[model samples]
Target chain A: MTNRWGLPHLGYGVGLRTVHYAEILSRWPAVDFFEAITENFLDTGGRPLHILDRVAERYPVVLHGVSLSIGSTDPLDLDYLAKVNRLARRVKARWVTDHLCWTGVAGKNVHDLLPLPYTEGVLAHVARRLRTVMDFLERPVFLENPSTYLQFTQSTMTEPEFLSELCERAGTGLLLDVNNVYVSAVNHGFDPVSYIDALPRGRVVQYHLAGHTDKGTHVLDTHSTRPRDEVWDLYAHAVERLGEAATLYEWDEDIPDFATVHAEALKARGLAAGIHREEVAVA
Target chain B: MPEPLTLDLVERWMQTVLVHPESAEAGIQSSPARALIDPGRVSEVVLASGHLTVAERLGIYQEMYLLRMRDALESDYPNLARHLGPHRFWHFVSDYVEAHPSRSYTLNRLGDHVPAFAATWGKRKERGLISDLSRLELALTRVFDAPEDPPVSPEALARLTPEASTELRLSPVAAFALERVRSASLRLLDSPEREVVPREAVPGSRHVHVLFVRKGGQVSRRTLEGAEGHLLEALTSGIPLGRALTRLGRRHRTTRPCEVESWFREWVEEGVFSAASLDPDP
Candidate 1:
C-alpha cells in the first residue's frame, strides 16, 4: 500500500473534531491516525496547541488545512507557509493537505472552498503555485477535489483530467475524496466511477469519505451525516483502483459521538479487506 | 461576442458575485460584478443544469458566504451573539465582515475587530454592556492564543532582599492586564450561562480593573481595584517595584505600604511575572 512517494498507508481514521476533544483525551480511542484542521492550530499557542501536543505524543496526526488557497490568484503567503511548516515539524505530521479550490481574492478570505475553472491556464497557474508551496515546506502536499455546485463554460477539460494533469505538473499527491467525486458527479451530470478511474492511482495517498446534503438539484459537501450508500460504493471503487490509502471519515456538524464516528470509519476496513482478498485470489 | 473569458476574469467575476451583499442576480448587476463582466454575459460563462439556471447556480455561493462568516463569528463571540439574538447577530455579522473581512490565513483571527466594532453599536440601548462583554470575550480569545511563557516561581520572589525587591524588574505573561471593567459586568461572565442574564444598559460604571493570565492552558481572570490595580499595571508595564509603588502611593493616597507588600506576594504566588531582574542603578 505504498503511494508514489512511498508515504505510509495509515489505515482508517476520523477527523479530530472539537466536540470529541475531551473524550479523546480521557478515553484515547483505538484509531490508527487523526486528521487535524491546520488553520485551527496555526494562530493559537494556548489550549488548542496544548491539546494537540498531547495528542501528537500518542497518535499519528496529519495536518489538513482549509485556508491554504493554493489555487488563489493572490500571491503566495510566505508567512502563512512558514507557520504551517513549523507546525508540521512540531507535531511531526505525516503530510499536509488542502483542497484544490481558491478561497478568496484581492487579499480578503471568504473562507469557502470555491471552485476553479478547469482550463489549461488554470492547471498551469495552480501547478506553479503548488510547486512553490511544496518547495517552501520541503514536502509534497496532497490536494483534494472540491464538490462543486456549478461548472464554468470556460472549462475545456473534465474535473478528473484537470486534477490528474495538475498533480503531474506540480509533483504533488491526490487525497481522492470519494464523497466529493459523488457530489460533483451528481451535481454536474458525470459518472462517479469514471471520475475515480481517471486519477493517477499511484499519486493517491489518502481518501476522504463524508456525508452530504442532497438538495434535489445539487449536493452540498456539508460533512454533516453518515456517508450515503452511493458514496460508500464509490469508496469501494477507489480502493479497488488505488489499492490502499489512509481513509478518513468526516462529520463536522451535528456530530453524534466519537464512538459513533469511529464505528463509521471502521466500515472502510471491510471494503479494503474485500479488495485485498480479491487480489489474493487473482494471485 | 466579446473576447473569450480568461481564467483570471472568470475568477474575478465569480468572486464579485459571491461576495455581493444582495442576491446573485442582483450581485451580477451590481457595479463590482459589472466592472469585471457584463450581467447579460453571465450565461455565456456558466453552464446551466436541469431546474437550476446559471444565476441560481452562482447564487449557491452567495448564500453560503454569509453562513460561513456567521459561523466563524458565532464561535468566537457566543455570548455576544446570544445577547443580540440570531436576527440582530446576523445583521451585525454582515456589517462587521463587510467592514473588516478576514485578512489572515486563519478564521481564528476573523473576529479580531469585533470588540472595537461592538463599541460603535450606539443605536442599541445595551450597547455599552455589549461592548464590555465583547471586550471580555476578546481578552479570553487573545489569552487563549497568546504565547506560553513559564511564570516565575514564588521562591524567586522570596530570594530577593528589601534592597533587591525595590529594584526588581518584572515581565508579565501575555494578556497581563485587560481594561478596567464594572464589577457587575465582570460578574456576568461568572454565570453558568451568560446569555440568560439580563442585559445591562450601562456597564463599567463601577470601575474595577481586571487581570488576565494564562494558567495551565486556561485563561483565568482576577479583579483588582485602586492601588492593587495601579500597582499590577505598573509592574506589568516594566516599572521597577519601588517606582511603581511610589507612583501608586502618589495617585492613591489611601494605599498603605503594608498592603502593597501583601499584594506583591499574592501576584508572585499567582505566577504573574514571567521573569524578574534587579533594576540597574541610575
Candidate 2:
C-alpha cells in the first residue's frame, strides 16, 4: 500500500557520501534516489552541497537528518528546524526524516541517537513535538526507529506499539529500518517480525537496510558492511506486509566502491520483486 | 521506593552517563546521574537484556561516544591526529570532549575550539607548533565549507583605470581565510610522511603567512610573499586599495610598485577578490 500522503516508492537507493561524490557526478549511477544527511549540507556551501544539488537534479533526493533531536525535552531548536526547511526546499527533497530518538539534553549534543521510554507520557510528548516538526516543514515527517543498545525499564509498551500510536496522533510517517528492528530485537529480546507486524500499514513510507556488527552477545548498528542474511529476510517480510516502499541501503563505515554499494542496494529490488510475485499468485 | 523518573530526568541521566569521561560504572555513579536517579538503581532504570548486563549495555553508548567524537575531530583535524598518533590523539579527544562537549547540531562546528585547546595542551615547547598546525588545518576546513561567492573576473579588474583602481575597495570571497603560523608548522605539513615525534622549538624560527581560498570547488593554499599579506589583510579589513598600499609601504621597507603590480595580478588570477567596488566617498 502507498503511504497515506501518497509519497512515491522511489525504488532502491544509497546514501550520498563524500567518497562517492566524484563517481556520482561523473557517472550519474542508476540508483533511484540519494539520501543526503540533512545536517551535512545544511551548514556548508561547499562541495558536499554542490554535489547534492547535481545529484538531486538527476535523481530523487530525500533528507535524512541525525540532529533533529525530536524527542529531546529541551525546547525545539527553531533555528535548526528553519535550516532544515530551507534545505528541503533548496534540494526539492521528496521527504525529510530523522530518528524517533533524542541526541542530547541541557543544550548539549552527544551526537548519538538515544532511545526514549515508551511510556504514555513520553508518547504524548513526542507526538506533540512531531506535529510541530511536520507543521514547520509543511510536510509529513518520517521518523526512523533507532537501533538501540539498551531499553528503559520505565517503558510500558513495545517500541512498535509506541510508534504506531505516535503516527496516529502526530500524522507522521515511518522510515522503517528492518535491520534496526532486528538489532533492537536481539538487544532487547523482542520478536523482530512482530515488531514489523505491529507498525501501522499505511504509515511506513520508506525502508533502511544496513550491515550491523554481531558481537556474539549483542549487535551494533555499525552499517560498516553488507546486510546479513537475517536482515534481508526481514526486509522481504516487511515488503510483503507493507507493500513497496522507498528503500535505502546504508553503508556509512568503510564503504566500498560505488558499484559494490549500489549492488548491495540492488539486492533489495530482487527480494521486493519476489515478494510482489507471491502477492500476485495469492491474488 | 525511589521517585519515578520523568522523560527529562531520564535524558539527563543517559546524557550524563554517555558523555562521562570515566567508565560507565563511574558515569552511573556520577554526581549528575545521581542527582536524577540513584546510582544503585541503574538496573531498575535501564534493563539488562540478552547476554549484556546493564553496565555493559550502557558501556556500548559510552564507547561509541568517544568513537563518534574521534571520527568527527579526525575528519576536521587529520594532521593534528596524525601528529599526535593514535594513543595520544585518542586521549586528547577524550579530554577535549569532556572540556567542551558538542553544543551544536552539526559536527562541523565541533572542532571550532581545537586550535585554542591545542595552544594550551601538550608540552609547553611543542604547544605553539601543534596549535599553529591546528589553526592552519581548521582554516582549510573553514575555507572548504565557506559560502560560495563568484570571484572577481579579470575583465572587471581590467575595466578599472589605474586611478579608479587606487580607490577601489576589494572584498575577499567568503571562501577565503588567512593564517599566520611558524615556518616549522608549514614545513611539517608539507612533509610527505607525517608521524608523531618529539618536536622542539627551533631557534629563530620565522613566521609564515598563508592564504586559503576555494576556486571551482577545490581548496588551494598560497604562501604570501613580501608585504602581500599585509596588503591583503588591510584590503579585506575594508581599507581602499590606495590606503592599503600606502600602509604596506610603511609596514615593509621592500614594498615597490613592480612587486605590488605582480601581487595584484596574481591575487586577481587566484580568485582572491570576490568583488571590487570603488570607494564611494573617494
Candidate 3:
C-alpha cells in the first residue's frame, strides 16, 4: 500500500558510507537511492557533504539520523532540528528518518539507541514531541523501530501497539526495519510475523533490511554482514503485506565492497518482485 | 516505598547503568542507579528474557557503550591509539569518556577535548609528546570537517597591481589549520608503519610548526619553516602583506624577499588562502 504522504517507493538503496564513497561516485552504480546519515553531514562542509551533494545530484537521497533523540525528555534540540531541515532542503531529500528511541538523558548523550517503555504516559510524551519535530521539519518524519535487547517490566503496551497509536496521533510515518523486528522478536521471544502484521500498513513508507549477529543468548543488530535467511524471509512477508515500499539494505560494520553490498540489497528487489507477481496473479 | 518508575526515572536509571565505568552489575549497585530505584529490584524493573538474566541483558548495553566510544576515539586519534597500543588505548578510552562524556549529538565533537585530557595523563616526561600528538591529530580532524571556502588562485594575486598586492590581506581557508607540535609527535605521525611507539622513544623536546589544509576534498599536511610559519600566522591573523613581511624581516634576521616570494607561491598553490582582499585603508 502506498503511504498517505505520497513518498515514492525509492526502490533498493544502500547506506552511503565513507569507505565506499570513491567507488560510488566514480562508478555511479545503478542503486535506486542512497541514505545519508544526517548527523555525519550536518556539521561538516568537507568531503562527506561534497560527496553527498554529488550523489544527490545523480540519485535519490534520504536523510537517516542516529542522534535525533526524538524520545528524549530533554528539550528538543532546535539547533539540531534546524540543521536537519536545512540539510533536507539543501539535498531535496525524499524523506527523513530516525529511530523510535532515546540517545541520552540529563544533557549527556550515550550515543546508543536506548529503548523506551511502551507505556501510555511514554506514548503520549513521544507523540507530542514527534508532532513538534514533524512541524519543524515541515514534512512528515519517519521513526524506525530499533533492535532492543531488553524490555521494561512496566511497559503496559506492546511496541507495535505503541507505534500504531503514535502514527495515528502524531501523523507520522514508519520506517520499518524488518531485521530489527526479527532481532527484537528473538531477543524478547515474540512472534516476528505478528509484529509485522500489527503496524499500520499505510504508514510504513520504507523498510530496512540488515544482517545481525547471534550471540547464542541474544541477537545483536550489528548490521555487519549480509541479511540472514530469516531476515530475508521476514522481508518477503513485509513486502507482501506493505506492498512496494522503499527498501534499504544497511551494512555498517565489516562492510564489504560497493558491489557486494549492492548485490545484497538487490536480493530485496528480487524477493519484492516475486511477491508483487504473486499478488498480481491472485488479483 | 521507593519512587515509582516513571519514564524519567527509567531513562535516568538505565543511562546511569549503561554508561557506568564499571560493569553493569556494579552500576546497578552504585549510588546513582540506586537513588532512582532499589538495586535489588533491577529484575523487577527490567524483565529477564529467554536465557539472559537481567544483569546480562543490561550488560549488553554497558559493553556496547564503551565499544562505541572506543571506536569513535580510535577513528579520530589513530596515531594516538596506535602509540598506546590496543591494551592501553582501551583503558585510555574508558578514562577519557568518564572525564568528558559526550554531550553533543555528533561523535565528531566527542574528541574535541582529547588533547587537553591527554596532557593530564601518563608520566610527566611523556605528557608533552602525547599531548602534542593528540593536538596534531585533532587539528587534522578539524580541518577535514571545516567549511569549504573557495580558495584564492595564484593568478588572482598576480592580477593585482604591485601597490595593491602589498596592501592585500590574505584569509586562510576555513579548512586550514596551523598547529605547533613537538618534533617527536611529527615523527610518530610520519611513521604509520610502526604499530606502537614506546613512551621512551618519544623525545620530549624540539617543537615544530605544521600546516593542515584540505584541497580538492583531500586533506594534506606540510611542515613549515620558522620564518614562513610566522609570516603565514601574521597574514592569517589579518595583517596586510607589507606589514607581515616587515614583521617577519625584524623577527628573522636572514628573511629574504626571494624566499618570501617562493613561500607565497607555494602557499597559494597548496590552497591555504581562501581569499585575498585589498586592505581598504592600507
Residue A194 of model 3 has an lDDT of 93
Clashes of each: 0, 0, 0
**TM per candidate:** 0.94, 0.95, 0.95
For residues A2-74, write the lDDT of model 1, one tens digit per residue. 6677778999988988789899999999999999999899987877888899899999999999988988888
The order by descending DockQ is 2, 3, 1
lDDT score for residue A178 of model 1: 89
Candidate 1 Cα RMSD after full superposition onto the native fold (Å):
2.9
Off by over 4 Å in 2: B1-3, B190-204, B280-282
Candidate 2: TM-score, chain B only: 0.91
User: Residue by residue across B14-67, what tens digits does model 3's lDDT show?
Assistant: 999998878999999999888898988887689998798888999999999999
Q: Which candidate number would show the highest TM-score if scored against the true structure?
A: 2
Each model's fraction of native contacts: 0.80, 0.95, 0.87
Q: Where does candidate 1 stray beyond 4 Å?
A: B1-4, B122-125, B175-177, B187-204, B279-282
Any idea what lDDT model 1 has? Answer: 0.84
Q: Which stretches of candidate 3 lie over 4 Å from their true place?
A: B159-167, B190-205, B278-282
Inter-residue clash pairs, candidate 3: none
| Model 3 chain B: lowest-lDDT 10 consecutive positions | B193-202
Per-residue lDDT over A1-283 for candidate 2, one digit per residue giving the tens place of the 0 to 100 score: 3457977788899999988987988888888999999999988998878888888889999999999998999999999999999999999999999999999999999999999989999999999999988898899998999999999898999898999999889978899999999999988888999898888777789999999998998999989989999999999989888778899999999989999999988989988988888889999
Candidate 1 chain A, poorest ten consecutive residues by summed lDDT = A1-10
